[model samples]
Target: MNSKRSTEILVGLFVAAGIAALFVLAMKVSNLGDFTDDKGYEVVANFQNIGGLKPRSPVTMAGVRVGRVTGISLDPDTYDARVTINIYRQYDNIPVDTSASIFTAGLLGEQYISLSPGADDFYLEDGDVIDLTQPAVVLEQVIGQFLYSTAEGD
Candidate 1:
């Protein structure tokens, strides 16, 4: 009876540990919209080249995530990317002079949008356009530039 009770306790402990492990895995891998509170309105920004920038990429200001890229499409006439950003409404106080820049994690890392807020009392309203936007930098283009520069130096 003593040996049986010990084995049961060990089994229970292992089961509890497994359950905890699964919970942690889900938290890490799931895009549960876990980090954001979308208390803001959506706005559009057009870019001539949105290279490798996909939906759900973070829209950050000064390295802090403020919003996300909600949608992407092409303009009917100019063929430019129409990127829709959903910012938290409380931060709608972001000035109209805010500039958007596409940045990478590293030379061969993921991409996310960066926002640079400018000093201006005027802020953006719903449906407003953020005209100052940058597009993602393509890796191939960077490699090409490196090769060309190396050849030139040689």
Candidate 2:
């Protein structure tokens, strides 16, 4: 009887470990497991369209993640998408003239912001606005244009 009880206890512990592992996996896949305590500096960029970009999307420079998107809103006057990015304080040397563009990871994957540094003596500071920005490319619009052009040619 004691051997049977020990086996049952071992099975219960195994099930609990599996549950904890699944919970951690879910957090990582959802980007909610970001354990960094870097409060970072905030910067703004304006775009005409921001496809599927959401808060917590990665901000990358040369394919390296430097920050995350903290907020996204619309400009009441210009009607453009205003994106707030919080760049890690360790990357405080980004130039003032750096340009930001939205890019997708794969054919139909998550969107992120990529920064291209420019030749400027000035470095971006908190509350600085990046004027040079490019909006995300909508695949539907591109396909529509391609189809129209092909039909016109025929």
Candidate 3:
């Protein structure tokens, strides 16, 4: 009886450990584990259309993730989509004239902001605005245009 009870306790511990491991994996996969101490710096960019960009979307530079989109809102006066991004402090050398473009990782993957560095003397600072911006290219629009052009040619 004593041996059986010890085995049961070991099994319970194993089950609890497995559950904890699964919870950690889920949080990491969903990016919820990025609760670091660094608050980073915020920069704003306006786009005419932001298709499916969401807060917490990745902000990448040269294919490497450098930050995350913190907020997205509509500008009432300009009627444009205002996107706020928090660049990690380690990537503070981004040029002021860098261009921000929305891009998809795979054919139908999530949208993220891609930064293209430019030749500029100054570096981007907190509360600065990135003026050179490109909006997301909707797949539907591209397909429609292609079909229209094909029919027009025929």
**lDDT (10s digit) by residue, model 3, range 45-142:** 99999989999999999899999999999999999999999998889999999999999989989999999999999999999999999999999999
Candidates 1 and 2 compared: the better one by TM-score is 2
Write down the worst ten-residue block by lDDT for model 1.
Answer: 30-39
- For model 2, how does the per-residue alpha-carbon lDDT over 1-154 read when each residue is reduced to its tens digit? 9999999999999999999889878786755566455687999999999999999999999999999999999999999999999998899999999999999999999999999998999999999999999999999998999999999999
Q: What is the TM-score of each candidate against the true structure?
A: 0.72, 0.78, 0.80
In model 3, the clashing pairs are: none
lDDT minimum window of 10 residues, candidate 2: 29-38
lDDT of each: 0.84, 0.94, 0.94
Residue pairs with colliding backbones in model 2 are: none
| Best candidate, TM-score | 3
Cα RMSD to native, each candidate?
Answer: 4.9, 4.5, 3.7
Ranking by lDDT: 2, 3, 1
TM-score of 2: 0.78
Question: Order of candidates by TM-score, top first?
Answer: 3, 2, 1
Off by over 4 Å in 2: 1-36
